[model samples]
Target chain A: MKKLIIASTSTVHNSGYLEYILPRLTSFFEGVKTILFIPYARPGGISYDAYTAIASKGFETIGIQVSGIHEYNDAQEAIANAEGIFTGGGNTFELVNQLYKNNILESLSKAVLTGTLYLGTSAGSNICGVTMMNTNDMPIVYPPSFTTLGFIPFNINAHYLDPDPTSKHMGETRETRIKEYHVFNNTPVLGLREGSWLEVMGDTITLKGNLSARLFQPGKEAKELDSESVINL
Target chain B: MKKLIIASTSTVHNSGYLEYILPRLTSFFEGVKTILFIPYARPGGISYDAYTAIASKGFETIGIQVSGIHEYNDAQEAIANAEGIFTGGGNTFELVNQLYKNNILESLSKAVLTGTLYLGTSAGSNICGVTMMNTNDMPIVYPPSFTTLGFIPFNINAHYLDPDPTSKHMGETRETRIKEYHVFNNTPVLGLREGSWLEVMGDTITLKGNLSARLFQPGKEAKELDSESVINL
Candidate 1:
């Protein structure tokens, strides 16, 4: 059976995100060949040095520039040859936009079902949900939210954090934002704070992170995940 | 020909909405029978007194008690009897959530296409865009952006106001929010300020309000509108 290691963000350039995943990743993909999907980092500009720096941590890393569908031959080959797929974090909207523009999200989803290991962090984690409509990012842009890649049945609100006490504004809180999503969405949401991740192996899901994930059922108060407990939905 | 008026918000309730529509509405809608769609006012509690107070201002007022698709009978009848329709504002997410659940968004869109005069205010105005996602209310909750009724092709960031001088915080200013939206969204957005109303009289769009409206398009600096201008899609 194939194994998957989905992270919350990439450690390549983001030292903080790297610190969170580097420890757990060594054992998670031990002896397994890893191919990193770096489409999310387009805004940061792609460089061989950057790719090698991230790869130097342990597993072999091959970067896939998935900017358009016409260039998808390499992306398809990458998904086929990889033991597991690691999608880095950047902008979920931009990532999904590129995915749809290149028509690879469906192909990747198919690969996951065929037992190819799937890993996603931050924006990558968000596309796991039913739709990308609930991202905390600005909504001026419209991406295809009809059907997500669906590695997870529910949507992931990555980088979920409590309101900063230092900030003062009248805007609704993150919890309120999730509740707004509940008003129209039947799918439950996983509020994954930074540094937290979900591990999917076979049919089991394990939550790993500092903050407890919060789940909201429509018309009900949000409930916190049990102390490091994994619940099958 | 059927007519419709969607206000920026409900006149009888909420702050920042205009009362100008109340007096003129009765005149413009004279001798025409109508029904007021109160999907946006669900949070304000649609009491009979409140309904009459708004209804007495013009033709006839009726609240849509639609919470879900199960109310198809009432939903259908309400749309059918009214020569025109009106949508009031409270929370855009709540309004869109209820409309989507009841599956009446497409029907309402059809109504508008067939020459139904629609007047929207505040949250009501926010829904006029291609994506109901451009709201300034912050993501207090995640509502479906893909399912907006699509009355207009562009997005609308409603209740556009400058930052208060007396306030201090780290939140992104309204100007900043619009800038972020432009990065990913190619669709132009109009920042409709409070007391402003975008009136559509058969292909004619007039910007009427107390202040100039702000317009943001991808790859361009934000522009302000001081006089009535026709938005050519």
Candidate 2:
């Protein structure tokens, strides 16, 4: 059975890193002593070591030691041996790029699917979907493919923001972008708002956290899913 | 001499489509009776014909007829004979995907390089840069390559927005995203805000329109370049 917590973000307003979700993580990752951290998505282009240190601090409070995959001699071995795996948020493009480059996508996916406990935030959560197409990150680097772990049947628009009616910005709204996505792709997309996450256990997927997630299916009206609802689409 | 108007967006707040810069377009596209419209970006997944109709209406005010490239049997020939070319914004990935699929990138680049009058808004303007790595649009589709026309020396972050201090959202800001891009690429990126544009006349590229554009070069501070300033870097 696959078990995962795909969060929309690692931090919320006025909170320390991973402060908002640590309580749930403690229970979700129970019995796991150490986690293999994939830090390739280095946010703002930080070094892998530095990014891993941040991840370590977040997991330290939960009594789980965090080890960056890069610290290992072989990344595939790291994933296979990790009691728990965590991919932190950063640049999805670079994360996907590095995953392809390192040839670890398969190992990482297999380990997680076989029931290795997993936690992903932002860019990390984006990869848990069918493709990385819904990522809001800039195309800082081109990955080999948009295909991802497909842990969830649908794609996830992490950190999804609703249209700000008061703003004068002319950019496409989050909904408009996802609708445009449906024109080329048939895959469903879930707009996961900040602090929201999808908890996957065995064959079931449930929306966790306080906010509602907006679900977008091809040629269908976007529906808002309240927290704790099962995401069938 | 190459002539192009690469704008951040076609429609600004409280303005009709292309109404923001029609006067300058009239001068830039002078003597052109008809313009080829590349509507592949198809904002909001609108059909090519539907998207073209929108472009036609915008260009009609300037006394120019708009013909979508899809209307022509031979897209290469259409580009070869076009008096003016306009690529409107939507989704950059799809736009580049179609351009490659149609094998029109070379022809389109050749036309623009040989002094064919050109206007690009949003997704269209994005291709005028070195790569589509800086676009804010969703990946929605996998483009053959991030490589673009390279009409200019650097990339353009169209519809660039400033950071909102009041917001609680944790998504990467436009500036942070571009900085991340710089880590992977040495190319300079101009954060072209809404209503701002870059005008290229032969070797001279000038910033046009109402506001200042932010420029991000690798390993340097982001500087604000006022409208009407020459863009040498």
Candidate 3:
């Protein structure tokens, strides 16, 4: 059975990197002694070593050793041997680009399918979907394709924000953007709000955390899914 | 000489469609009897005919007749003979996708270069830049390339928003997204706020409207460009 923790964000407000989710991660990654970190997203243009260090510190609190994929000579071999896999969030385009360039996308997908514990935050969670088409990140670089790991049945809009009723900005709201996505794509989108996540076990996926996520389906009105609700598509 | 009014948005808060900029557009499109409208952006999932009708109504006030490029059997021929052209706001990915599918990217670039008065709002304005890499719209569909008209020297971030100081949203701010873009691209990006625009006449591009715009260059701190300031980059 596949096991995964796809979180909206690694950190909530007023928290350290991965601090808010560390406790949950410890349980999700139970029995895993080490985690192979994929830090290609490079948030704020951070270096790979620096980003890995943050992840390493977070995983250390749970007694798990962390190793960045870059530390290994063979990225594919690293995934093949990883007891657990964690991809950090940054720019999705950059992350997806590096995945294709390193030729580890297929390996990573296979590792997760064969029951290696998987954890993804933001951009990492985004790639767990059918496609990275719904990511809110800027297209800093063009990836070879928008295709992603397809571990999940639907796409995820991580760190999803609710439209502020008092805002005067004329840009499309998150709801509107998803609606536009539906016009071209039939894939359902889960708006994973901050502090929220989806826990996948075998064929069942359940919403975890306190917040209710917004679910958008094609040709239908968007609805909110309460915490602990089974995400049935 | 190229004449262009690249606006951040077609409408401002509490204003009718194009009401705020109609007067400037009247003079900008002076002596032009008819304008070819590209309604490919199709905001709100509106049909091309419906979107074009809105543009037609907006232009009717300026004594110029409007015809959607969709009405023409040959889009390239329509661009070749256009007295003036207007591309309205919608999903940037969809707009660029259609532009590529129709094989009209080169023709549109040619039309604007050869002095067909061009007006673009939001997504339309975004394409006037080197690439549509900086747009805030969702990537509903994959385009052949992020490359655009390249009528302007740099990229544009339309409907540019300022980070909310009091907000607790964890998603990357507009400034952060632009900074991420700079990490991979050296192209300068102009953050055109609603009520701000770029008035391009030949080689000179001046920031218009009452609001100051933000200019972001790679490897430098973002700075605000005052209204009416000439954008040298």
TM-scores for the candidates: 0.64, 0.99, 0.99
Model 3 C-alpha lDDT per residue in residues B53-159, reported as the tens digit of each score:
99999888889999999999999999999999999999998899899999999898888887999999999999999999999988778888999998889999999
**Candidate 3, chain B, TM-score (2 decimals):** 0.99
lDDT scores of the candidates, listed in order: 0.59, 0.93, 0.93
Off by over 4 Å in 3: none
Off by over 4 Å in 2: none
| CAPRI accuracy category, model 1 | incorrect
Error of 3 at B127 (Å): 0.2
Instruction: Specify the highest-DockQ model's number.
Output: 2
Q: Could you give the C-alpha RMSD of every candidate to the true structure, in order shown?
A: 7.0, 0.9, 0.9
Candidate 1 lDDT, B120-222, residue by residue in tens: 6667677777777577542333445544766666777765667666543323456766666665557788887655667666666667655688888877878
| lDDT tens readout by residue for model 2, B1-233 | 89999999999999999998999999888888999999999999899999999999998998999999999999999999999999999999999999999999999989988999999999999999999999998998898899999999999999999999887889988988998888889999999999999999999999999899999999999999999999897
Q: Which 10-residue span in candidate 1 chain A carries the lowest summed lDDT?
A: A62-71
- Can you give the lDDT of residue B57 in candidate 2? 96
lDDT of 2 by residue, A1-233 (tens): 99999999999988999999999999988898988999999999999999999999998998999989999999999999989999999999999999999999899889988999989999999999999999999998889999999999999999999999998999989999999889888999999999999999987999999999999999899999999999786
lDDT per residue as tens, model 3, A16-44: 88888888887888898999999999998
Where's the lowest-lDDT run of ten residues in candidate 2 chain B? B164-173
Worst 10 residues of 3 chain A by lDDT: A20-29
